[model samples]
Target: MDIPLPTIAVVGLGTMGTGIAEVLARAGREVIGIDISDAAARRAARALEASTARAVGRGRISAAERRAVLARFRTFSDLRAAADAGLVIEVVPESYETKLGVLRALDGIVAPSAVLATGTNALSVTRLAAESARPERVLGLHFFHPAPVMRLVEVVSSVLTSDRAVAAVTALARELGKEPVAVGDRPGFVADGLLFGYLNQAAAMYECGYASREDIDAAMRLGCGLPMGPLALLDLIGVDTARTVLDAMHAASHDRLHAPSPVLRQLVDAGLTGRKAGRGFYTYEAPGSAVPVPDALTPSPAAGAVPGRQVASVGVVGSGTMASGIAEVFAVAGYGVVLTARSPEKAAAARERIAASLARSVDRGRISAGARDATLARIVPAGSADALAEVDLAVEAVAEDLEVKRRLFATLDKVCRPGAVLATTTSSLPVVACARATSRPADVVGMHFFNPAPAMKLVEVVRTVLTCDEAHATVREVAATVRKHPVDCGDRAGFIVNALLFPYLNNAVKMVGEHYATPDDIDAAMKLGGGYPMGPFELLDVVGLDVSLAIERALHREFRDPGLAPAPLLEHLVAAGCLGRKTGRGFREYGRR
Candidate 1:
């Protein structure tokens, strides 16, 4: 059995409304597009004709189909024109009073059996339903920007919303070629709830001088595989709109993470709303331009170069995954590498791992067989710390334990040449703590790499207060030699990525604990609305709930900020041994081999 497509009435001819009307018309539905101003109605009609012509030009639709689609659309400036519509959707500004006014007006004009919907991202659908007489018929059909292109539509159902009403919209979404996820009526629903918190945190990081905007964005793009950085995404989604969503979510949950950063308010106040206004965190070429040029506020990349000693040969100490990856990175860059492990057996295991990794790279056409052989030839495996005697640099990538790392650095300080730059690949523990362990504190630096180091491009070059200009330059130069993007920062708790990332993940856990929305819905919201590569829970599962908790705890312990504390849900999950994919369970279940 199939449900009949309804004649749709879209009240409002703004960007969202016009896009929705175009979608409906293309789907062969009789679409009545309404606007209060005559000029706005005329403009929408012209826009539709132009858009359809472009579609024809792109060969997306035949000229006959374009004419047919245009004939299905009817533009009007009066509300009574929708009296016969089976469904009426209001797509006005995201303001409670404005939407409520539109809904009340639609309630009087549409038939008693007609379904009423709003395209709101953050407002309360339940409260909006109460304003109409037929509350059971009211729900939310939230389409993302450029509704015709984006495939997601959140079919939100309030407590008073009838299942029949929800089913109607869900079917309508499928008819119009959109994916619909059923969500409960709440502020920001699923997507904005998890998204704005992350964006707000990025703004705070920039305001605090934690890192430059470019570095902050690059960290996420290279580190997490996101399509765009948070700051740039914020610019795409206007600053004023982001603030409105954040204010609404904060009002509902009272979570500090949702509170808008002061810089956001200042930007909006300064008329730098975003791409729509021509200037934001980054200035645009013109209003509504997608391309962004460097603004006066862009921070310079890495302080002026320092005259440092050349790094020709490197030593990597450990038997762990990170250690092997680091050794491989250096060897492939034409640097002689000495990899040391505690025993002959462990050294053999590290060699095998690196060999298998290189073999895979060769099979994938990422490197030639000759290049792989040459890279492997550059690595020298040793079973003792004495092998690092003459290397220009030695990096300790052993473990996260402070005592273990400190012991290695002390040994390196004793064995390596005095001018050799000693670095630690610690992601959480302070670089200075490692520096204090070595005799040559001025030569100690931090080079933090994301997992699967050979593939991920980011390397946060951390410098302690005692680190000399020469040491910093050597590490930065090495990072560039390995074709990694280096961002310099002072010794800090989580560096840039973990400091900004973990808190956002922790907030998602709290949202789940509070029963605000289902995990799947939250994940879909973030992916569809924010264009993130993965949802917070999905990432938590992949990274391991236990590992995430440890990082969050370290962040809280160092900063003493209550907001950074690990969520109770995370603690319980870790304690219950639902570690993640390794344990076959975490926030979601996984199939084990």
Candidate 2:
């Protein structure tokens, strides 16, 4: 038995509501759009015409098809227009009182069996359902912003919600070409539950001046491959709205992670809500404009920057993939490269790996054969640290162990010349500790490059208290010479990227452990709703579970927050030897390489 919800009424025709109405009409369902303001109702109608016309111009729909879609959608200023709708979805504001009033009013308008849904991402769906006349038919149907584009629709079921009501809407969501994830009654459900906490951390980090807003945003975008930076995304999703969501989340869980940052409240009180108000984390060209204009908070390119020490030659130590990648990057940038390893054979093998990578680039037409030959010729592989004596800069790319790095820095201290800038590529160790191993503590710094260095453009230029201006500036300059975007941060546990990233990963593991959602549903929710390049579980599998758990431990040790502790599920998996793709099992199974 199937219930076809062919006629849908979308209440409150704002951006999200209008997008929903357009999607329903395009899917061959009659859509009645209701908004209190005549202007908003008219604006939605105009936006649909422009959208459908663009679709016709782009060959997405024929002229006849566009006309029919337009005809299927009708706008009204009263709730009476929804009397014939089989389902009514209210996309009003996020306030509890505001949403409850709409659902109560819709109770008498639609048929007794007609389903009523609240589109609040933060408020309690169960509470809203309890206040409605037909509690069994009321639920939550939350669509992401720009509803026509994003494919995710969270079909939220409260305790009182009827199974038949859920089934009918789930089927309708599929017919509308959306992936509907069934979620329990909770603030944020799956996607926003994870998303908002990460955003709140980014806000708190900026508020504390850990990094510039631009640098914080850029680190996530380049380092983690996120579509937008946190601050910019906060501006897009109104600051006031974010605060409301966090408040609801904190009220339920009382986790400090869900507590809204003080900066959000400040921004809201100042009326700098977001792009809708033309200002927030960053300033836009105008109210409701997408373009960001320069503001007082924007960094000046030349402000207080110290000049860097010059380096014509570089020493890259170790024979791992990162070592070879670093050597290739320096060589490609026309710097003389001395690549060293534990043995002559290992050093030569590392160079051969570089040769193969460059050969692939040449075959793909990315670089000239002559350029590849030149890059290979510039790298001189050697068997010992003695070869690094005269190089202007020395970079260590060994395993992520503190003692191994300290011993290497002690070696670099004696072997290399006094003025040479000594550096370590340690992702999580203290740069200050590495510097202390050397007599010239001022010389050591951290230059963290993401995996497959030449392809990833971001480099974190780490500065410790012991690191002098010259050493810090030299790495920033060298990073630019090799065409990498450099972001600055103090010497700490995870730097910028890992600090915000690992905590979110830990929470996702907690979610799966709690049996609230499956990895597949949560992954789909984040990918389609939040625009992540890869889901957390997918990334955890790629980056070994062992590696992820180790980082999680490091962060928890440094922060000492209960929430930052590694999820017991992650630790148990590591204990069981299910250490991800390399082991052919992790959060998910994969073919062993």
Which candidate achieves the best TM-score against the true structure?
Answer: 2
Query: lDDT, candidate 1, residue 400?
Result: 90
- lDDT by residue (1-593, candidate 1, tens digit) is 33244689999998889999999999999999999988878888888899999999999999999999999999998889998888998998888999998888888988877899998888999999987888998999998887888877889999999988888889999888887888887777667666678889889989998788888899988988888898998998899999999998889878687889999999999999989999998889999998998878776654665677898999999988999999999999999999999987897789779999999999999999999999999999999999999999998888799999888888998999989999999999988988899889999999998889898899999999999999998998899999999987779888888988898889889878888767887787778766778888899999989889999999999888777889999999999999888899999999984
Give per-residue lDDT, candidate 1, residue 115: 91
lDDT of 2: 0.93
Residue 508 in model 1: lDDT: 82
TM-score of each: 0.95, 0.98
lDDT of 2 by residue, 263-283 (tens): 999999999999999999999
Q: Which stretches in model 1 have alpha-carbon errors above 4 Å?
A: 1-5, 300-304
Q: Which regions of candidate 2 deviate over 4 angstroms? A: none
Top candidate when judged by lDDT against the true structure: 2
- The CA lDDT of each predicted structure is 0.88, 0.93
Worst 10 residues of 1 by lDDT: 1-10
